[model samples]
Structure formats: C-alpha cells, structure tokens
Target: MAKSERDHQKVEAAKAVVYIYINHLAYHISPETAVLYFYQLMWDRLTPECLPVRDALTVVIEDEQFKEEQGLQFINRSYYSICNPWHLDNKKRPYLKQIIDRLDREPETESINRTTQALREQWMNFSKGEYGDCLRRQMHLGGHEIFREEDREFRNVLADYLPDYFYLYRSVTRTPDIEQLEQEHSHPEYSGTATKQINRLRESYDAVYEYRNLRQQGVTGIDHPSRLELAEFEKGLDFYYPGRNDSFKSKARTICHKKRRYEKYASYRPQVKEYLMESVELFPARTKSKLTESIDRALVRFDDRTSMDPITSKSLFLGLLDSVLLPVPNTSNILRLERCVGDVGPMNFTGMLLSLVLACPMIRFRLEKKLGYLYRKFEGKSLEGIQWVVDLFEHINLALVMNARKIGYFSLTEPLPDAA
Candidate 1:
C-alpha cells in the first residue's frame, strides 16, 4: 500500500513551488511571498485576529515603528504606485488637480502565471460563478495532495491575474460584460481591511477608467487624450506585476525620427488598469459594489446583466464586404471597418452597418474614442471623410419603427375594460 503524504508536507511543497515558479518566471514575487513578507514587515502590525489567513486580504501590515526605525525598506510602494500620475517616490502624493489618464493597452501576457487547482477551487467558491475565469477554472476539486498541488498552481496562476486581484479590492472586475448590472459586488474576504482597501483601490482604478472612456467616447464631450499622451500611457503600464519585462512597442519611436520634434518618455505599460476602470464606472451606485455586502450583491446584479439578453443579444462578429473580404487591414475601408465594429457582429448586418458607420467621421471617432484607440495623426487623415452614418441609422431605425407600427407590433390590450 502507498503511504499518504502529510497535509503539512503538501503545503510545504506547494509553497516551494509557488516561490520558485514566481522567481524563475512570473517575476517580482508571488502573493504567497507577499503574505509572508507582509507578516515579517508588519511584525505585530496586525492584530492576530486581523490576519489575512481568514477573510481579511488587504489591510496593510505596516510596522509604523519599524517604518520609522528601518526607514524606507518598510514602505508599501506598490500600493501607492497604483496612481501613475503621482511621482514614483514613496512618501506623499501631492493633492493637486491631478489629471487621471486613460490606459487602453493590454498587459504583456507571455510570462504571466497560470491558475492552480486550489486557487481555482477557492476562486470558484469565492466568485460563486459571478466572474467567469478563462483558465484554471476547470480544475476546481481534488484530493489532499491534489489540493496542495492546486494551491501551488493557484499561486502561479493567481499572480498573473494581479489586475483582477486589484478588482477584488476595488470592486471593478465584475463579471459578464453586460450593458446593465443585475447583481452586487463579491469582494473576497482574504482579510477585512485588506479587502476594504482593495475596494478603495478598485474605486480609484475605476475612476480613472471612467474619466478616460467618457472623454474618448465623447459620452461627456471631454477632450480625448492626445497621441503623445497615448504613447505615454502605454509606457506607464509596466508596474502592474513586479519584474515585468514585456514591452508594448512605441509608435513614439517612429514619430520621433520622422519629426524629431517630440519628447520621448521611457518604458511600456500594462493596459488592464485603464480598460476595466472605465467599464466599472458606468454602473449606478446602487448596482455598483463599493462596500462589502453592497459589492457582493452588486456582483449578482452584474452577472445578470452580463448574461446575454435573448430578446436583444448583441451579435459579436465582424463582416467583410461582399465586394471584397480580407482578414488583413490594408485600406482605409478595412481600417475603418475594424475601427467601427471591432469584433462585434451577427455577420449579415455587421458588414452593412460597419460600412455605414465608417462612412460617418463622427461615429468613427466615437467608436475609436470608446474603444480608446490611439489616434495617430499620421494614420487618420481626418475625422472628415466619413460623417453622415448617424442620420442614415436614424432613418433606418425610424423606418423599422414605422414598419413595426404598420404590422401592429404593439399589443397594449387583451380586451377592452368595462367603465363605470
């Protein structure tokens, strides 16, 4: 008979795997390591009951006295770095009229960690099918040793998902990208204060998102970020995961040589921060998750919204012209087509509407702005050539309404009610 591995043995191995995996590949450090470092750094900074092992995930375990004694080693620089507008220096961020910029670039995915079985199980239970996960989601249950292996895997996978982790604290990464919310927030109780702080961070993270989207989408008629600013935003995303070495390549490099008139900023950035923040702010506060239970409830509401509405489910596909269809973006027509519809469609109507959409410069600009597409002056000739698609759509929908009326689409009465 085979002997059983003690639970402690499994945990130790899992811990070693997590540490080594992150060190060799994931870069920076794993959250498991973060937990340990936090314990040592904070030293008695947290009351025993307030420890994160329970439900409290984000209360900073800062040793105030140690911070004073050991100087900057104890500083929680990562927490503050969340606001890129602030200086990288540790101390205080100036409370001036800080401009919150929008980030649209996606993160470098090459070295990011993958989900482990343990984390998948915990997350599945924690999220309760609220926020759908792409990976590590399939393996949610297992035996003792298997559970340990899963935990180690979770450490690996979970580390890569830092942006989503930020959402747990901040209430931003609500699942089911729906037009309307149907549930509340579901912040994990890794720790109370830590969880609360995550919520706060989620708010700030989300606020920056709203500011950028509203500006780009022209939802509020605000000025969109300039091309140079877009380049800078791309550069600013590097800090999300520690020791990230990926690059978002610069158009700045090209422009600088061509004109030699622009100032070039350094480095590439992670784009997740900007995208989710914008999406999170669109919800009403009642539907939004800012507090504990409020957020938990908000997740339920959000899940419902993300659920595709059978009555009016938006088709997700891109259409090519019947005249000439090509996957590559080669012409102004092709670029405009991608810009106007992205990956949304039902095929038949997608091609029809996109051609018209690109026909209107206003709609084109709106789609570009909403998607937060960086507008390169060298690329976009002008927001001019296409500008009348809006009237056409209005005419189309209006005609549809008229036809519906003629066909008696409305049914207001089953029968006439008797009046006294």
Candidate 2:
C-alpha cells in the first residue's frame, strides 16, 4: 500500500479504537468519566511519532460534530453524580480549615499536639483535590455559580468566627451551668440589668430575634446544642455581649434553632415551577389539558394515597416534567418522557407535545417565547440545527467505530479496566 493510504488506514484505526473505548467506558463507568479516560489514554498511548493518529483523535473528540452526537452540548442528566462528591468535599474543607487554624492558634500542649497531628492528616486528604473533576464538569452543567456562592458563604462564616474557637472548645470540654445562667437572668435583683443587656443585643442584631423566638419555643442550653449552633452562639456572645464568659455565651447560642446553611436547594422549586409554566403556556388550552391528563396518569403509578393530594401530585408532575425537559445530572428520569410517548401509557399526547417543541423548528417559535433563555444560550440557533449537528457526529462516531473494528485495532468484546 502507498504511504498515503497506509496513513489514512492508521487514522481510521485510531478513530475506531477511541469510539470503542468511549462507548465501553460510558457503559461501565460514566460519560464524563469515559471522556476523561479517553483523553488520558490518548496522551499515554499515542506518542509524538504517531502525529496523524493523535491529531485525528483530537479532532474527532473536540469537533463540534462529535460533541453534539454524544449529547455533550447540553448538560447530561447524570452530571450531578459528578457534582455530589465535590459538593460534599467543598462542605468539609471549611470545617477542616477551621480545625487546623484553631489548633495552630492553641498552645502546643500534649492534647493540642495530638489533635493537630490528626487534623494535619485530614487536611492532606482534603488538599488532594478529590472533587477537582466535578468542579471541571460544572462548566458544562450551568448553575455552578450557586455552588460557588455557597462555598464562599461557608468560608466567610468560618472567617467571622475564627476567634470564637476558644469558647467553642471550652464549651465542649466544660459543660456550661445552664440552670445557673438562666437563674442569673431571672433573678429579681439582676433581672432588670440582664433584660436591658438582652434587649440592647436584640435591637442590635436580627439573629437575636430569631434566637429569642427559638428560646420561647422551648430550646435551651440544657437540651445540648449542635456543634455549629454552639459555635454561632459563642461567637455572638463574644462579639455582642463580652461581659458574659465563654461558658455563658455557649449556653446562649444553644437557645435558638439552628439556621439553615444553604438556600439554593430551597429555591429550586420556584425556578422549576417557572420553567414548567412557561413551557405549558406555549401550548393551547386543549394541549394543556392533555399535558395535565398525562401527568395525572403518571401519578397513578405512585401510591394512591400520596397521589391523591393535589399539591403532591402537582409537584410530582412538575418534577417529572422538569426531569424530562431539563434533566439534571445524577437525577433519575425513569419516565423517559423525552424519548417516546408510546412507551409511557396515556403520556403520548404530552410526550408528543414535548418532542415537537424540542425537535420541531416551527413549534419552537412558540417555545422560544417562553424559553428564550435556552435559545439565547445557543446564540438563537434553532434546535433543529443543533439536532442535525448531533446526528452528524453520531454518524461519524459510529462509522469510525465500525472501521476500527474491521481493521482489528481494538476489541469491542473486551474493554480495558476503568482508569478511575
């Protein structure tokens, strides 16, 4: 064979190898994982000598055609699996830093030394960037700003309470005299003085009102505060009511309900509801009724008791719709309403509506009126064009896979072990 033909054959073989590897890895591992694995394999196996194959593989993977075909353009519903570990790791980092900073500030006593050593080991693990891949995955998923905001809040809270660790540690080791502290405030002679101080503090900070409410609702230091709650109370006392010793402040902090940490999850309902309403509005009244009927039918599959509540049914129906329309990574879309209406009983009409809006350009004009944000992100291009691009990539990827298999470059029957 001529050198040109041989080079072409080599490139074809490499493309096939990548196709087989990507599909196999995606099945056993995950799509994101598979992509990373493919990148690593190419870098490791292909040397500078095989520039043709290397360039071909890079072009095939990076090409817009390939990406759209693999559903890489829109966020994968399974992408949340990638984010969850990172979210957990991100949550732990602040606490670990707090511990490390606290230990560093303390005198090097035997107990402090032991704690410091243990914390250092934990800090090492945290520094390993275990969630680094998840952080990278978020670029494609959108809404990453929410996670970043929460992380910032976590760090800010830690920074604000750095000095209160001393009190926090004392609270854990030496239990506060809850009854004595309460009595001091309640005593007739000291009552006026304590009440004046409490009122001043309450007036100064809104958190005090929340604390007082919790106290009125029966929360007390004797009930044993969580570490976080105890920390907040100690910090408040140290900053706002310094006359009270660390122990007293610790007891005070336990007097309120713990504040929630993050509000992003809480906001999901309104956001999803807004999108569902917008999508529904694009349809006529008759179509809207059909959509509702489909949701009601799907609800029947769940427990009748739970499905009977209109609110629950509505939320579930919206959740199902959201799952189909804007499926988040790591969530279950068992209904698969996005695929075909015939598969899900009585859901055909709703399914057909979704399919038309998502796939048909003419109908998308109506959809764009409600879902302009989606279009804006894609630079006002029609979904049909995007689908076409994806289809083109799928064809190329499959052809490459077939050519590689025919050339006997890689075995589809036996996949390599997971790199992860």
Q: How does each model score on TM-score?
A: 0.17, 0.18
Highest TM-score scorer: 2
Model 2 C-alpha lDDT versus the unseen true structure: 0.32
> Model 2 over residues 151-235: C-alpha lDDT tens digits?
4333322222211111111111111232234355554223222222222222223343345456668887643221324554434
What are the per-residue Cα lDDT tens digits for candidate 1 across 10-126? 433433332242223212444334334433322222223333321121111111222231122112221112221122211212210111110111223232222222222232232
Report how far off residue 340 is in candidate 2 (Å).
37
* Best candidate, lDDT: 2
**C-alpha displacement of 416 in model 2, angstroms?**
41
Worst 10 residues of 2 by lDDT: 166-175
At residue 109, what lDDT does model 1 achieve? 23
Instruction: Tell me the lDDT of candidate 1.
Output: 0.26
> Which consecutive 10 residues in model 1 have the weakest lDDT in total?
95-104
